[model samples]
Target: DQQVKQNSPSLSVQEGRISILNCDYTNSMFDYFLWYKKYPAEGPTFLISISSIKDKNEDGRFTVFLNKSAKHLSLHIVPSQPGDSAVYFCAASARSGSYQLTFGKGTKLSVIP
Candidate 1:
């Protein structure tokens, strides 16, 4: 089975600092990678994504990087904020037409002021 793994279960960062979240996947066939952020008692919201063809994709403070050779990817949040504290999940899909995400366990980030 294709699996996404997050080595760190949680991370702590002071406000205005950078937060780096790591993830690795086992399947080379997977072409799409995504990150989702979820708050307590709420559904997850899409954070960012990157295609296998591209090494990096960025939107404002959120950036997703893909290393197809290593089957590894990471998300970087610059100047992390307290509101950024949430559970982050890394997901991947081989299907391009319809996305069925195979998600990592999740990494909870606590951004402290």
Candidate 2:
């Protein structure tokens, strides 16, 4: 079974500062990883992702790093803004053809201005 852990329930960062969210997993079968940002009453929006073959993937202000050896990953947000404050989820999927996603509880980010 696949299990994801986001030990930190929430994070607080100053505006324009950097924010780092951590995630850990117990499943090696996962081949795809993703980060999503969610707001109240709205569905989560995709942020970034990394394939099992890649250790790191970046897009604009977001970067996702995966450590296959330790089954761990982290998402970094540079120059965090107030609008960036939202609940972030770390999700994983396997290439077993099922195409199912397993998600961590989530970490709420608070970017204060």
- Clashing residue pairs, candidate 2? none
Error of 1 at 45 (Å): 0.7
Top TM-score prediction, candidate number: 2
Q: lDDT of each prediction vs. the true structure?
A: 0.93, 0.93
Question: On residues 1-113, what C-alpha lDDT tens digit does candidate 2 reach at each position?
Answer: 43988989999999999999999999878999999899999999988889999999989989899999999999999989999999999999988978788999999999999
Clashes of each: 0, 0
Model 1 agreement with the true structure over 46-83: per-residue lDDT tens digits: 98989898999999999888888899999999989999
Local error of candidate 2 at 16, Å?
1.2
TM-score of each: 0.94, 0.96
RMSD of each: 1.5, 1.1
